[model samples]
Target chain A: MHNRSGLLEACLLILLKENKSYGYNLMNDLHKFGFEEDSLNISVIYRNLRSMEKRGLITSSWAESDQGPRKRVYEITADGEQDLKNWIWMLKNRKSQIETIIEKYENLK
Target chain B: MHNRSGLLEACLLILLKENKSYGYNLMNDLHKFGFEEDSLNISVIYRNLRSMEKRGLITSSWAESDQGPRKRVYEITADGEQDLKNWIWMLKNRKSQIETIIEKYENLK
Candidate 1:
């Protein structure tokens, strides 16, 4: 029931690859990519982070932040990079299928 | 876990809208739309058909076919048309988000 498109995980990996980011900053970045705040909850982000770390796709380090509490900054691993590539392929595949359906529907209209 | 993109449902609705179809013919049409036979199981199609009928999105009638066994031909209902529109909107929304992520990654590379 969570992100059937798997966009959230892809975005997280891409953002981590772009730069090491903490959960709070990642949450903010998600908004920039069109994710709703309700859908991109803090707990959901944390859960995915933990799962990704467990999968050896990402690593995190606790760092002291000047304005707030210590933050866990995450960085994508080599495995994570490869996984992102696979996800990209899957997304492209799904996109094509969707486009085909849309085309069929438009023709019907 | 089934069709996170909801493409299957959308395709079925669109096909039904185009013409009333029996389950067997629908399976063949799916191949034309890029769905692999292995991925598009007959059972999966029936399950969706039953679910849609239960939801009042489609209606089916048993018919006698001269060439083979009796088949239940399905046609989209009024509610189904509305639902297809909603699915189209959702698909477009998800597509935009995926494109943004792909763009960001390409820029990173």
Candidate 2:
């Protein structure tokens, strides 16, 4: 199987692609999909969010709050949308490759 | 696209998935596909490798080297092979998602 980083990052992007969210929100949402494990590190989420923001794939704004601290809400940008499109293309391309490998493995088995 | 981490990590896994290779080899090979940029940080490779190994998706061993330190070569484990399957599955599912987003973006454009 592939490493967890891509899946986790892709998932968070997909989530923000749908709507704006905060770091904790992403953590909670992703947790439902088996992202709560050690492989899905909490720091990874923050790191990806910042990295994506720097790439112009996502943009974030701080929401003023009375309690705790200001929450950073991230929204997908236009470039982010296109980026997601490319990611989708990568996924489609990997599909064929995986099929080939699976067939080969089955044959070997 | 969907945050550089996933693409980079996935690309790395896809590399090792082909055959066992060392960190530098994986980094250099991935660099061939636009991974040399800042978004594809070098440390990220080792981090994902460790994470993947921890998940039981990959296995690694130190190979004796003549020129330098022992080079760590990693191979996909049985579970890792299965994990790659799941990763491929995730990619396939994202295809439809990206298509829908593209059509929407085009309509807005």
Candidate 3:
């Protein structure tokens, strides 16, 4: 399942902004962020990429890969960069929420 | 919308574990953890509460309130407490995922 926290978009945005990459590479990279097989699916990432592209947050182009067929390479647009920044701010802003839950747990114990 | 991270159940579990509380109070307490007007809905909380109860994670009792009509007070069951612990561990484990995103953001600047 796709991460429902709505932060997956931010993750994709940040990844694309940092270095333009193909969908497969992007999907692989998402694993580091707790988007494992159980929680994430490649199709979901693709759908989100399409959705982001439609929203103009990202753009894609056909590019030849060394090992295989041509792939669609995604890059973050200026709008995507700004949206990424906002997402980071929001995540950092809400860091305390998770921390608060942790704190409550500690107190309970 | 309810928090889709699946941590909302943990939050509710923690609250009930700490002290048995009625629905309204539990809803209000959720705000401290980022469950606000935009992201959290009362109906969703109730649904989750019912789901948890059905799952044998929590139990509820009706109590007379001086302020008003009888209210259903919820308390965490043994299974619920264990579930809360598991959730805490999972959140802590995934905390780095968020930090990784933040780190990537910093590197981009």
Candidate 4:
């Protein structure tokens, strides 16, 4: 993921890559990734899923979970896999560019 | 910055590095950075500034601009500078970690 906004989505992809999940599971996983508990905005995840679905990257359906209500379960589509692959490629090739920017901003003695 | 959530805030720091700016100006600046006009949420920037101010990373004061209302002109605090420095350092050191993760994600064949 390129930015904080991509965070939830990135996590979503990681989760979907493993298995489809509901909001609570995603939120819990985010906590594992060190996202502040209060800062875990599930709505952002939901919104990103919606956008990704619109882009043919993901698909969702109301599924019954052991927990509360009917949750939206999401799975990665072929396009979603492709998008993730491309993002990873960018991260690989842009490593030097990212390093340069960071070094210019950071002054270590 | 590290993520999209940090985009607005990172842009905020960059802008503050240049000069104090109003909301509209910040929005315009985001457009220059290729943030979709609609995706350029000034509210997130304002919120990050408020949080940064709370953490003593930034300070703001009402400044009379030639525009409509009193705009909050924010400047980076000493702590903010140090935070920026540390973030940059992390960006440098974590480059390999990031690349490794991205590589694990991507399969370019």
Best candidate according to lDDT: 1
Cα interface RMSD of each candidate = 1.3, 7.2, 1.6, 5.1
Cα shift from native, residue B21, model 1 (Å): 1.5
lDDT tens digits, residue span B1-109, model 2: 2333244445556667777887877877765444324545568778888988898878899899989889989987788766666655555444444444344434443
Full-model lDDT for every candidate: 0.86, 0.66, 0.82, 0.64
Compose the digit string of candidate 4's lDDT tens values, residues A1-109.
3334243555567667777876667778756444556765777767777888899888889987676788888888888888777666555544654554454344332
Chain B TM-score in each of the candidates: 0.90, 0.82, 0.88, 0.73
Q: Across residues A1-109, which tens digit of lDDT does each residue of candidate 1 receive?
A: 3335678888999999989998889999898788866666798789989999999999999999899799999999999999999888888877787788788888888
Report the C-alpha lDDT of model 3 over B30-86, residue by residue, as the tens digit. 887776666777897888999999989988999998998899988888899888898
Candidate 4: C-alpha RMSD after superposition: 7.0
In angstroms, give how far residue A14 of model 4 lies from its true place. Answer: 2.4
Kindly report the fnat of each predicted structure, to 2 decimals: 0.67, 0.02, 0.57, 0.38
The CAPRI quality class of candidate 1 comes to: medium
Model 1 Cα lDDT, one tens digit per residue, B21-97: 98889999988788876777898899899999999999999999999899999999999999999999888887788
**Model 3 / residue A107 / CA error / Å:** 1.2
Q: Candidates ranked by DockQ, best first?
A: 1, 3, 4, 2
Runs of candidate 4 with Cα error greater than 4 angstroms are A1-5, A32-34, A93-95, A105-109, B1-80, B89-109
Badly placed stretches (over 4 Å) of model 2 are A1-109, B1-6, B32-36
Q: Is the docking of candidate 2 incorrect, acceptable, medium or high quality?
A: incorrect
Clashing residue pairs found in predicted model 4 = A3-B3, A3-B4, A4-B3, A4-B4, A4-B5, A5-B4, A5-B5
- Model 3's TM-score against the true structure: 0.90
